[model samples]
Target: MSLLTVKNISLAFGGPLLLDGAELTIRDGERLCLLGRNGAGKTTLMRVLNGDLPPDGGDIMRRQGLRTALVTQDVPADLEGTVFPIIASGLGEQAALLEEFHQVSRSLQSSTDPALMERLAQLQKRIEETGGWQMQQLVEQVIRHLKLEGDAAFAHLSGGVKRRVMLGRALVSDPDLLLLDEPTNHLDLETIAWLEDFLVRRDKALMFVTHDRSFLRRVATRIVELDRGRLSSWQCDYDTYVQRREEQLEAEEKQAAEFDKKLVQEEKWIRQGIKARRTRNMGRVRALRQMREERRARRERSGTADLAVQQGERSGRRVIEAEHISYAWTGQPIIRDFSTTILRGDKIGIIGPNGSGKTTLLQLLLGRLKPDEGRVKLGTNLEIAYFDQHRGQLDEDRSVQDNIAEGNDWVEINGQRKHVIGYLRDFLFPPERARSPVRTLSGGERNRLLLAKLFTRPANLLVLDEPTNDLDLETLELLEGLLVDFPGTVLLVSHDRAFLDNVVTSTLVLEGEGRVGEYVGGYEDWQRQRAEQIEDEEKKPQAAAEKVQPQRPGRDRPRKLGFKEKRELEALPARIEELEAEQATIHEQMANPDFYRDHGDEVAQLQQRLEQIARELEQGYARWEELEALEG
Candidate 1:
């Protein structure tokens, strides 16, 4: 059955029509992805779905009994409330009524009137029948699956954590209709994986508004695009959507071009006719007039060029190297004995779970950190620029042009003291938006401004952290093209798997605790490895068990330890201690700035690896320790 239907929905903000004649339908178990450039009315459409924004001219049909919810990035930053109350929003009116019903039922059960007792029993049964007892567990599962496993206060949590809390809130009630607005924006890779798995088993219809390509591919069964206030739907996944959308745009462009050419030709011929051509050729003139009328009726679809990032000459043969580096935060070591080497034009992507020190490693490479125990080295003439996730370099109070202008004190084009307006124009910023403060710009705009700043720098090696945030699809495509053609090297920390696939030739993944792994190829190669691992496990379940845990299965009796097991247990403690020491050393090295100038990037990378190895070593040790201390 159709869960909800929207027809001819239209909404206007000030003078600009955010949505016009947008139509969409959500069916039972349907998964749809809403795609468009930033400010293209996706969020507004979601609001229309929830009936929160009554369209200026439209009607909606919904199931007689169904609930809906939206999860957006505005997950109140200064959340003073408990996580329990946050998740309760998904319950909608049922939660409120449930509470009121429970209180009234309790009061009724205590009354002497026989009618009251019967009514109380009926209400109690209804509440229990509605899965009241199971609801809390559902909420907890949502909480855990989204990976918000900590009890820290909301203010202390990162934006990503709070976003997960909001996600949990949205999923707790299992509403008939779900609207997810950029759910994966701030989530870590681990959480994203968990979400992908969770969404696969979801029964409720889902309408996801997101720019994350991987998330769309994993979760969406259909794609809908909002163009010029009109919504069009496609029956396909993200890859298929890409092809279809491109074809549609190409066809539309061709039609518009042909119509325009014919209109020009008609006008030219009409002008050329003059008095020499006569009323005798009246039919031809009439034909030209009809052609102009047809041309006027034809719709024109226009596309703007995405931003362009130019890469300057390579700095040196050896761009960056790190040696025996170590770093720690609040006594928790992140990098240990890490070493890595970067060649000219190497587009390296650093990825891992959150708190894996991906950002810290970037800082160390860019000479922002002083390794406690080792040194980081850079090649002579190597210039580096860093783009942090928060856009730390950009002045929030200043204009977008001010930020870019600060990169170089001089002007670039014609040396006319390039104003902030000129720089912003090159970035596709309109004249009205040029003077706007950085705080007023949308996510995509800010990201564009950041890119503009990066391109204007003297750096040959760019280290970008979470550069995909708030960026539109157009800009991402531009970035991918730029990276592919860039002459200089790039070292990046990004969670966008698709972006990594397109732009990165090599990968350095930092698994928390101080270990980092290097892989060649992009996301496809990584997925293949994971698939092989799964296949191998299926082929040898017993072996896999032995590799990960005890080999015993379906056994009530515990097996006695063999000599090999005993030796393994005995060596584990000492091994764990060695790793702990190594982790400490790597953290110290990552903290030192001299490491960048004195050693190779390989040294810094080795320190990163040591950090990861230390983590694995600890896990192994802990497992062995458990084996040795078994009560069995």
Candidate 2:
């Protein structure tokens, strides 16, 4: 059933036109991933659906009594109070009912008034109707899952923590429709995986904006891509969506002479998708418009930026060597007895849950922090370029060009002097945008600018922390291409599964409690190996138990059975066959993609139950063998 319909939605912010007669129908149980380049107005469109921003011309119709919750990209500074109360407020009606119910109960306890009893009864009825307890329980679960500090003030929390809180609020609301902008932003790999499982299990309609390709593959049932003030819907996963889009574009190109208008439309959408990530707020729309000419000029002049990272003087074969490194802060050890060797041209990706000391390890390697025990040796002629998640090197007060130039008229690229504007263009920043304050640029644009700065300086080692954050799919691909092509050694910490798979040669996994291990291959391969390790560990105890168990006399043969047991065992083979057939059906269902996507939780339960059934079937066969021996 369709929960919300957006018809003829035309919105323009007096700058670039967005959502030109766009039409979207959101159905129940649909997990739609919204994708687009920066400045493509994806956020604006989401705001329209959220009723936070009304379209210039359109109609948003929702089913009667349909509830909706939105998690915005930026956490509002004005949202005061502690995290717990703020999140509890998202429960809406149920929150009020719960409070009223508690108040009425208190009143009845204090005085035996009949009126109090009546009020308490009414509140109780409403609470049960709204599932007030369930709503409260969900809120608590969300908080715990997101690792929120319940007592922390909203303003005092970090940006990432604040974003998590907002996400928790929206999820806990238990709305019919949930809209999230950059839902995966500021989340670690563990949290992202947890959220993927959470979304897969929930039947609620979800529309989330994310650049995480793996996330889209796991969670999205449909994709609504916003481009060139239009929306294109695809009922498929991320990979299929890209394949279909490419094939369509290829066919359009082949028939371009006859369908020039159609070709133009396709190209416009492609051009819109090339820009990368969205700005921090919609207010920057005018500034974005100023770059339109630059965008056009660049298209007319050349294709995408040639991001050739200039390698500095060659470092020794050993780029970095750590000897028995141990670090502790206030009696709590973050990294203990960790040792690693980084050779020249080696690309390593660091991954772990949030607060797993990935960043601290990077800092320690760079000599920013001294280890309590052991030493880190840097190779000769090593010049390291670090890209932090916070983009701390960027000066918000400085113009983009100034930030890049750093008071110089030009930058040296490959030992050649390049004009600041030309260099900025290489990072997808237009000449006009170069003059805009760094703070005014979108997160994606700022990240690009940061990359631009990093590449200008010659480096033998590159250290990137969450570099994929705020980057669009296209830019992410470009980054991966650059990393793959770069001669320098790379030590990267990113939650992007696809990006890590494409770029890194090895992975460093930081398991909490001071455990670290290295694995060959990317995130996916590492995860597979880890899962196998866990399975092996689980089987060890069972294997040991079976091996150490006492054996009865004549165990090699079968044990004797009484007459009643013999009759029961006679039916065991047929029962075992029935279970095997049932298991086959469940396996078939699990193998079906649609079944798993639609009923993830049920499928998981079925898998567990199937194992139990298999064991039971095996036991039945064993009993039947014993009974057959008695007949013999």
- Segments in model 2 whose C-alpha atoms lie over 4 Å from true places: 97-130, 251-305, 548-632
Error of 1 at 145 (Å): 2.6
Tens digit per residue, CA lDDT, model 2, 1-632? 99999988888867557777889999999999988876678888878887789889878998999888888767787899777767887887676675565455445444555555455556545655676645655665677778887668899988988999999888877789899888888888878877898889899999988888899888989999886677889988788888998898678556644444544544454456434324233444444454454444321212356576778988899988988888987788888888988899999999988887899988888778899999998888889898988999999999999988888888888889999998888777777778899988887887888888888888989999998887777778888988998888999999889889989999999887877888999998898778656545554565575675533234244334434555687788789889989876875664454553455346335635654775576567657765677678
In terms of lDDT, which candidate is strongest?
2
Best by TM-score: 2
Name model 1 segments beyond 4 Å from true: 77-79, 92-130, 265-302, 406-426, 527-632
Q: What CA RMSD would you report for each candidate?
A: 15.0, 14.5
